[model samples]
Target: MDARRNDVNPQKYYVKKLCKIIYFMGLGDCWYERTEQSRMQKILYAIWATLINSFIILNTINELLAFLRTDLSVKEKNDSIQFRFAHPCLCGKYIFLVLQKHRIRALFERLLEASRSVYTVFEVEKRSVWQAKLCCLVLAASSYCTLLFTVVDAIVGYFTQGIKIRTEVVLYPTPAHSGLLINLLRLLIEVHWWCIVTNMILVDCLSSVAMVYVAHKLMIVKLYFQNLRQKVISNIGKKSDLEIQKEYEMDFITGVKLHKDALWCAKNIQYALGNVYSIQVFESITLLGMCMVKMAKIDINLTFILANGLYLVCVVIITGVYFSSAGNITYEAYEVHNAMFHSGWELAHLSPASRAVVLVAIQRSQVPVFLTAFGVVVLSHNNFISVVRASYSFFAVTY
Candidate 1:
């Protein structure tokens, strides 16, 4: 997870991680150019990915069938809450993610191309950006390690301990007893489950990166606006009033243009993640409710408690990462507006052209710019809180 000393650009660092994830997921390489060799590579990757991911899809169907076949009375308490409700909800999230693989690839492709073009600008990264990148990497790496250790212990437990259904590994419908074939199937399920988690992690990282880009741009606009007067005076220190006003107008226009570009990028991010927001908004409560209710229950098994606890924390972390990064965007956008408001633009003697340009920037900045899903659920801390509160309500009712 540590970035190489030579590798400093967080943009490229995340782009590489994204490409690897999508590649192994059986989606083609988003970073590479089309060539004969790359084409063949894509084909091979598709086949390998198809073969592995097909197992997950099949197991998901089996899970649904098994859940349905169980009687209503049997599902009331026990471990059924998770195996029946929570797991399926998570799977539903992943299913929508998987179903839009093509759209995801296209989205990544556009960003990949844009990053290549703007690599020089962001080459020397800021400390805050680097820290955010590392935070994301750590979150994802830790999640994987947790699941990996659980599976390894389960595997070892299978041979050393006894034949038992590992609530962690054998999440899907599987026989309690282990055999060579059954063990192989369980192994596949574990690997596929890991991939599903990886897919979500990678996409979330990508979203974080996109939000970071927009926030950075907003910060630039704010800084530029704050120094707008100084920059113009320094450039035309001895110029006439007319000349100075003209210089200010040009500087103001450039700032507004950059602000517009940043908002455009944010809008694109919203479009790409619209469905994800819908899923997170609508289904996260149900998922978290299941986890909380299951966790609150009087369960003697340590593994059960640990699994549900881990799941609940992971869900909160993922949702928080998405919303918190997005909330920063809104916060930063406001800073831009604040800077412009105090920029002393009104004090300057400006012609109609300069005044009109200032008004344009003011008009745009009047409405706080933030990403939203379907123009409803703003990706900010408020909605994040709302989701958690609703989940807690569900838990309280069920408990």
Candidate 2:
């Protein structure tokens, strides 16, 4: 009886302690495992929540519009409204179901564990940084794809609902008369198309930049885990003062490596930022090309509005999201590095050869991401700014 009671006490004590740790860690009891998310994770959850809400709202609005256009019976109308309201709930349930896979659970649990290491006072291997970044890449890709689909849907909706138009008259071409006004009007059309097409390209470029930035972050995460694994194995052959300490370190190291690897593999491949960047680049360019072809058939006056107003708004939104996502990714990487550096692991303490390894790893892990993000922002912002200025110029000249 006493033995059983003792066993129960330890288990209960651990549970209570874990609960307290979780509470302080800022990760609520929502995750089944006791692991907590870093700042990035919390931000990701919030962003994802906002995205889901937006999608639901947009879908609901679309459905309502459809319902208003329909001449349905009272019962059918009520049923359709109810169905639309429940759609988001159903989608949530389905997402949960997918997350229930054992492999996925393992990956999530590993990531949660990694998140904790970022705060550890001891030398932490740098692998978790890569893992977190990879996760972000996956997440950002999913969001980008959804946003792309939304854009496509919006364009389709415009076609179905009919495009808004502004009036402009074209004078008949005359061989006998050289009218400067006619030439000027034609010039305006060319300028309008140029602004619209360029703006669309800029928005597409922003999307690509976001995707690439996320991918670069993932690479860092992978490096952190790899370094951690090498450290653990290297320490295995060394003699330590306490047998228990050796065993503990080895166990922790093995567990971390395994957890990271599991999570690394289980994540949604489709969500990877690597493919998202290239694919989006191709798709966006293609879509923009199509828009240009379509625009060619329409009047220059109408195109001017879309180019100046509609495309301008899209470029702004795309640039905003791109920069925001890049900032998040960079911040998370810094946090991971800060945590691991604090973990008592010093690059200087390692042997010369080991120090080289560590330095190489850090350089590879961080530099590419920063470069990609830098390039994206520079181009996206400049293009958007140029389009805005040119549009204003066109308006000023024409009016």
Find the candidate with the highest TM-score and give its number. Answer: 1
Which residues of candidate 1, in runs, are more than 4 Å off? Answer: 1-10, 30-39, 68-80, 83-124, 145-163, 168-173, 176-178, 235-237, 301-303, 373-375
TM-score of candidate 2 on Cα atoms, chains taken together: 0.30
Model 1 lDDT, residue 71, Cα:
36
Which digits, one per residue and each the tens of the lDDT, describe model 2 over residues 307-373?
Answer: 4234334434444444344444445545444433332234224445644544554443343223132
The reply for model 2, stretches above 4 Å from the true place, is: 1-113, 117-279, 293-296, 300-312, 319-399
* Span of ten consecutive residues with least summed lDDT in model 2: 1-10
Residue 175 shift from truth in candidate 2, angstroms: 41
lDDT of 1: 0.63
Clashes of each: 0, 13
What's the TM-score of every candidate structure? 0.81, 0.30
For residue 174, model 1's alpha carbon misses the true position, in angstroms, by 3.7
| lDDT at residue 370 of model 1 (Cα atoms) | 77
Spell out the clash pairs found in candidate 1: none
lDDT of each residue in 53-150, candidate 1, tens digit only = 67656765555455443332221234445545544544565565566655555554554344333222343245446855875776596667657555
Quote the lDDT for 271 in model 1.
67
